[model samples]
Target: MSNKFFSVSVTNISVAILTTILISACAGNRIVNNDAPVEQLQDLNDYDSDGVIKAREKCDNTVLGASIDNYGCGNQITKMEPFKIKINFANDSFAIPDNAYDKIRVLADFLKENQEIKVVIEGHTSKVGKVNHNQTLSEQRAKAVVLVLIHDFKIPAERLDYIGYGFQRLEDERQTEEAHAANRRIMAELTHTEHLDEMEWTIYSVDQEL
Candidate 1:
């Protein structure tokens, strides 16, 4: 009878030990899963500042013969002439008029055709408003054009640059409203001129107002 009791006790002990071992293994696996390092999620399809998505680009979209920097952006290999393309804005506004569409289309086409030529589109305003206010408005106008190129025309962002000069860089400085309207404009400057070293324009002096 004592032997029988001893055997039963030993069998129960073995079963308890086995259950504990199984539970410990499951706990270990849970801990490992909880502590596993998570991989950072990179959006391959997202548009970069230059409006190019690396995932879908066939060409590396990098300047040829350029060296890559620490952040993987490339160095400039060639100096291009700044091509000037100007678009006048409506009175005190940057809204694109229907008449302006064709000209914008042409500019977009030109930029698309010449992939190597980067453009700096500058926005300027007349001297009617405060200088600081004009500067901000001018920048917004330039950015508006950029949006059109990037979103509507699918122009790559790398080919575009922008700045706002406000009333500081005007073609004319007549105090009349008509002159102010004429002064408000968006203009392009090519970063690298394949054929020329520089571009020339008749920039009016901002010091004197008619």
Candidate 2:
């Protein structure tokens, strides 16, 4: 074998041409449209820009910046509110008073909006009266309020129930006018489930790399 030495000098322009050739060779099947290589790394199938790809995404059109799950659904949330309404009645009356109409209407509106809610209208009386008489009066008071809800506000019959607790669950045990007045009242306990989409917490942004 003969010893042969070859001297090769490459210019900057020649080196650049060789580099472009190597890059083109590396991208054998991939289309090169003068775009950056980073585009190839991004998930182009994700149309909504959510992390989940189109084939796997269960939810579509997910809001941008919403903290989405693996299924790509976001903005679905649940909420609960502690609601109570109190309306005091006269010494020996079960009438829905003029002044108490606004609060009752508000309660009705709440019920109208929240279809899943059920309301319990409770009635109580002072200890000065006989237990049996007070119980009957309490029953009347609660029933009166419930009727107003059903008739006036168009509240559904199935969503309402009345209960009497005459002198049993007194707000104050003292034998004073204020205590008696406070004890003689109608109360509504509200229960429901609330869900909101627009008012949800999030931890995502467009600034982040997809």
Candidate 3:
């Protein structure tokens, strides 16, 4: 071959080799960067922007129009009113009456459902007795209720507290029997550490295969 023709052929071969090397280098960089292909990255269905995959959500009967959390469970604001149950005792007796069982059951159910709520049981007595005697009677009444809650109703002892108010804070000071009966009572006050409506998010894990 002539020198000029040979030179042209050599240059063409070099250009082809360089082009192949450049393409290979770009492919290698993509592999090292671990970039997923466009088809693999694209979601097949419309997903919620709230970070929850609908198919993987575990909660059912979610409230409509309410804001959902990361688990697709809607936020619910449970406002519980303070509950009170009065158990009237016969004069000088701390025994729980049969009628008080239903009220105690209601209180137990409430405590069971709301585990975070703590209750204080206050016992009060009429002013017909001496200060020390009344105080002891009041304490016994409060403790009796606590025992029933813990043993019969399976309420946690840690969530309950009792105090005896005795005749110091009488609900009624009248000399009538009805007023005195009202004063001999047990009061349960439920309190929470935080407001029930405070915003909290539910966290859940999704199955990657789904």
lDDT of 3 at 170: 91
Clashing residue pairs, backbone N/CA/C < 3 A, model 1 = 50-157, 80-192, 80-193, 81-192, 81-193, 83-190
**How does candidate 1 fare on TM-score?**
0.52
Q: Which regions of candidate 2 deviate over 4 angstroms?
A: 1-82, 195-210
Q: TM-score for model 2?
A: 0.56
lDDT (10s digit) by residue, model 3, range 63-114: 4333665566654444435566788899998999999988899999988988
Q: Against the true structure, what is each candidate's TM-score?
A: 0.52, 0.56, 0.55
Clash list (residue pairs), candidate 3: none
For 1-210, candidate 1 gives per-residue lDDT tens digits of 699999999999999999999999988884434676777575465233333456444335444333334333544445745445456676567777667767778889997887877778888888886878888889988888887888888899877878999888767767877777678777887765343212112243233333
Candidate 2 Cα lDDT to native:
0.80
Estimate every model's Cα lDDT from 0 to 1: 0.70, 0.80, 0.79
lDDT of 2 by residue, 18-67 (tens): 99999989888676596655545544498887678987788888776556
Cα RMSD to native, each candidate?
Answer: 19.2, 9.3, 11.1
Name the candidate that leads on lDDT. 2
Root-mean-square deviation of candidate 3: 11.1
What's the C-alpha lDDT at position 113 in model 1? 86
Which model is ahead, 1 or 2, in terms of lDDT? 2
